[model samples]
Target: MTRCRLCGSTALESVVDLGATPPCESFLAAERLDAPEPTYPLHLRVCTDCWLAQIPPLITPEETFSEYAYFSSYSSSWVEHARVFVEDAAARLGLGEDSFVVEVASNDGYLLRHVVDRGVRCLGVEPSVNVGAAAREAGVPTLTAFLSPETGAAVRAEHGPADLVVANNVYAHIPDVIGFTKGLRALVADDGWVSVEVQHLLTLIEENQYDTIYHEHFQYYTVASAIRALASGGLTLVDVELLPTHGGSLRLWARPEEAAGEPGRRVADVLAREKAAGLQELSGYTEFSARVAKVRRDLLRFLVDAAEEGRTVVGYGAPGKGNTLLNHCGIRPDLLPYTVDRNPYKHGRYTPGTRIPVLPPERIAADRPDYVLVLPWNLRAELVEQLAYVHEWGGRLVFPIPELSIVEVER
Candidate 1:
C-alpha cells in the first residue's frame, strides 16, 4: 500500500480509483500514435490520520512538465483570471517598483505580465522550457527550473526575498508538498505573504470532479489539510478565499510562523463549512466512488445514444481533465470523432489515451457537427459563448461532468 504522500500515514483509505491512465498532458503526434504509451494507476487515497487526500507520484515532474504542452495563455478566460489576480494582489500587498515579486510555476507569463506592467519587479520560476521560453519572449523574467528549497534560496539570494510570492494552481501538481511549501517559506519576506491556489478537494467530491485526478496532480487539499500541510513547512495559514476558477479553488494566504496572526473570519467560515460537509471524517468519502462511477455511465449513455440516433458529436478544448474523463470512460474517436483546441501545439496532436484527433476550432463551423461536446465543462460558459455560432445551425452544446446535460442555446 502506498503511504500517504502528505502525512506519511499508513492508514490510507481508497476514495476513488480511476484505473490506469496515461499522463494526461501527453498529447500524441500522428507518428507516435502507434508507439506504446505508458500508463500508471490513478487512485485517490485519504489518510485517516490527517484526512489529506493524495495520489502517489508514479511519474516525475521532469516527465510531466519539462516539455509541457498546455499553455495558460491559450484560454482567454484563464488569462483574464490571472490578470485580475495580479491586479488584486498587487494592491492588497501595496506593491511598488521596489517590491520584488516571484511567481512559482508561472506559465507563459500569463499573470506576471500584469505585475511588470504595474512597475512591480517580479521573477517567474517555470520548469517547462517551452512555456518558460514563451515567458522570456514575452519579456517576463523567468528561470527555467522547478521551484525547490535550493532554487528558492538561489532566487532569494539573487533577487532578494520576495515582498509577495504567488503560486496559482501548482500546489497540487507538486509531489514533494512539504518541500514546495518550505521553498515558499524561503522565498517570501518576513512581513510578506505567500498566496497559493489549489482546486478545493471538497468541491472535487461534491461536484464529481474526478476528471481533475491525473498523474500530474499528486494531492487534493481541503482547508484543514492545506493548513496542516503548510504548517509542516514552517508557514501558517492566515486567510483563505474560495475562488470559482478551475471548477473551485482555494486561495490560501500564509505568513511565517513567527508572525503573530489569527485565522481570519473567512478561514473560520470555510473550515466550518468543510467540517459541516464531513471533510474531517473517513465516512464522508464512502459514497464518492459510487458517484464518480455514475458519471462514467451517464456520459457513456449520452454519447452512445447520440451515435445511435445518427447524430454527429465533436468536442471542444483538449484539456488534461478532458483527457482523463475521456480515457476513464473508454471513449474513442468512434463516439467523439474529433475535438478542437485553440493552442497551436495541441492542434495537430491527438488526445493521450482516447486517440481522438484534435483540430482547430474553425473546423467545428466548417464541419457543423450536430452536437459539440464541451469537454472542459468547468469552462462551459466561456466555451458556449465562444462557440455560440453553432446555434445558428440548430446545434447545441453538451456537458459530461457532474451530470450529463445538453446546454440549451438561444436561437
Candidate 2:
C-alpha cells in the first residue's frame, strides 16, 4: 500500500533496509539520555515508475530540523567549498550588488556569507533557529522558516524574484520534492538559474554508502528521477556537473520551464551514463541490499577485533550519517569509546542511538588513540589531513564505508 513519495507509484520495491534506528541528528543531552528515545524503520524503496529511490516520510521537518545541532561552518574544507562555489557562480551568472541571491537551507550562512562578501545582495532561508541566529551574527540576513511554495511567494513579493537560487544538499532533506522544486520555480525570475546539489544515487549504490540513508534524507535521486521531478514542477534541467564532495554528488543547473535556453550536452550525456549504468532497471538495486549487509558485518568484525586486541579506537566527526553507520552496526561507546567534532554545539552531547561521548578535537591528541575511526568517510581527505599529527604516535585511520580499510597517514 505504500507509494513512492515522488511519483506515487505503488510498485515500490525494498532496496536496502537498515532496520529500526533513531533520527541521525537526534544527539542527546545528559538529561534526555535517561528518557525513552524513539527509533523509526530506516528502509529505502525504489519506484519502478520513475526510478526515484526514497524513504517514507515517517518524520516531519519540524521534528528533524527545527532546532538543529549541525553547523556547516565547522568543517574547514566544506567552508572552502562554499567559498569556491560562490566565486564560480558569481562569475558565471554575472552576479553583482544589483542582483539578488537566495539560498535555501543555508546553514550558518556558510555559503551566503561568501555571496555577501562579493558585494552581492543575498538572503538565507533557514528553519533551524540556532543556525539562523549564527548566520545573522555573521552579517548574513536570514529567515528562520522552512522554504515552501508559500514562503517562496512571500520572499518574491518582498525582495522581488531572485536572480540566483541555491539549494545545495537540501534536495535530499526535503520531504516534498515536487513542492520544493515548484517553490524554486516560483521564486526564481524567468532568467534566473537554480542550482541544486545532491549525492548521486549511482555512487551510493556502487560504493555501498548505506550510511547516507537516514531519516533526514527522504529522497535519493538519480538523473532520471531528478529530471522528472523538476519537470513536474515546471522547471527544466539545463546543465549538470559531477562533484567529488559527499562521496559523489551532482550539481544540477535548472531554469524555469518557460524560459528560452538550450539544455547543455552534459544533461543528455549524464542521462545516457545513468541509463547505461542500469539506473532505470531493478537489477541495479537488487544487489545493493546484500552489499550493504556485508558492510555491516565487516565493520562489526573490525571493531570487535580492535576491542579484543586491547587497542584504543576513537571516532572523528559526529555527523548524522556517522550516527546511522554506528547505530546500524550496533556499535556503542564501548567499541567506539568517544568521538570528536569541531562543532561546539555537539560537544558534551552524546551521539544518538550509540551514545558515544562527543568531545573536542583536542582530545584526539591528548589520548593519542591507536586508531581513529573516521565516521564521516565522505570527508576522509579533509579529516585525514587535519589529523595527520596522529601519525606522530604511529596511529592510523579507519574508514567504515565502501569497505573497512585501515590507512596510515604520513606526516
Candidate 3:
C-alpha cells in the first residue's frame, strides 16, 4: 500500500486510476524510438486522515526536472499572467524598492523579472540547470540547486530572510511535501509573506481534468489540505485566491504565527465551499474518477470516428498537460498527425511516448488541416483567435476533454 506523503496515513483508498503513462516530459529523441518506454502507474489515492490526493511514488524530482526542457518564458499566456501577479503582489503587499523578494523553483525568472522591473531587491532559487541558466542570462540573479532544509539554511546564511517568497505551481511537485514547506518557513522573514500557487483539486475533479494526473504532479491540493500541511510547519494561511491558469489553481499566502496573521474569511469560505462540494467526503472522488473515465472513452470514440470520416486532425500547444491528455487517451500519429507548438525547442521533437511530431505554428497555417485539436483546452479561446485563418478553409477546432466539441468559422 502506498501511504500518503503529506500525512503518512496508511488508511488510503484509490480515488482515480489512469492506468500507466509515460512521463509527461519524456519527449524522446528520434534514435531512442523503438526502445521500450518506461510506463508507470498513474493512480491517485486520497489519505483518509488529511484528505490529500496524490499519485504513488514512481518518478523523482531528480529524474523529472533536474535539467528541465520546458521554459516558462515560452508561454505568452504564462508570461502575461506572471506580469499580472507581480503587479497585484506588489500592490497588495506594499512591495517596492526597499523590500526583498525571493522565489523557489523560479523557472526562467518569469515573475522575478517583473520584480526587478519594479526596482525591488529579488533573487530566484531555481534547481533546473537549463531554466536557471536562462534566468541568469536575462540578468535575473539565480541560485541553481535543489531546495531543502539545508538549502534553506544556506540561503538564510547568505541573504537572511525575504520579504516575499513566491512559489508558483511547485507546491505539488515535491514528495517530501512537509519538509519543503518547513524550508519555506525558515527562509521567509518573521512578518514576510510566502505565496504558493497550486492547481486546486476541487477544480480538477469538477472539470474532469484527468490530464493533470502526471507523475511529476504527485499531489493535488485543496485549501484544507494546504492549511493542514502549512500549519504543521508553523506557518499560517493568510489569504487565498482562485486563478484560471492551468485549468484551475489556488494561490495561497502564508506567514509565521509570531506575525499573528490569521487566515482571511475568503480562505475559510473557500474551504467551506470545498466541503460543501463534497471534496472532504469520499463520493466526490469516486464520482470524479468515473466522470474522467467517461471523458477518455468519449475522446477515443471521437478520434476513431474522425479517422473513419477521413478528417484531418492536428494539435495545438505542446504543453505538459497536452502530453498527459494524449498519452492517457492513447492518441498517436493515426489520430493526431502532428502538434503545432509556439516553442521552437519543442517544434521538431516528438511528444513523449506517443511520438506524435511537434511542428511550428506555421505548419498549421500552411497545411490548413480539416480539424485542429486544441490540446490546451483552457486556452482554447486564445488559440482559436490566433488560428482563425483555419475558418477561412471551413476548418473547425476539436476539444477532446470536458467534451468532444467543435468550433466552426464565424463567417
lDDT of 3 by residue, 116-230 (tens): 9899999899989888999999989999877787888789889888988898989899888888888888789998989999999998988888888889898999999999888
Q: Using alpha carbons, what is the TM-score of model 2?
A: 0.98
* CA RMSD per model (angstroms): 0.9, 0.9, 1.3
The alpha-carbon lDDT assigned to residue 73 of candidate 3 equals 87
Per-model TM-score, in order, reads: 0.99, 0.98, 0.97
lDDT against the true structure, each candidate? 0.91, 0.91, 0.86
Model 1 quality (TM-score)? 0.99
Q: Where is model 2 more than 4 Å wrong at Cα?
A: none
Candidate 3: residue 200 Cα off by (Å): 0.6
Candidates 2 and 3 compared by lDDT, better number: 2
Error of 3 at 383 (Å): 1.7
Which residue segments of model 3 deviate by more than 4 Å?
Answer: 409-411
Q: In angstroms, give how far residue 111 of model 1 lies from its true place.
A: 0.2
Q: Model 1, residue 192: what's the lDDT?
A: 86
Which pairs, if any, clash in model 2?
Answer: none
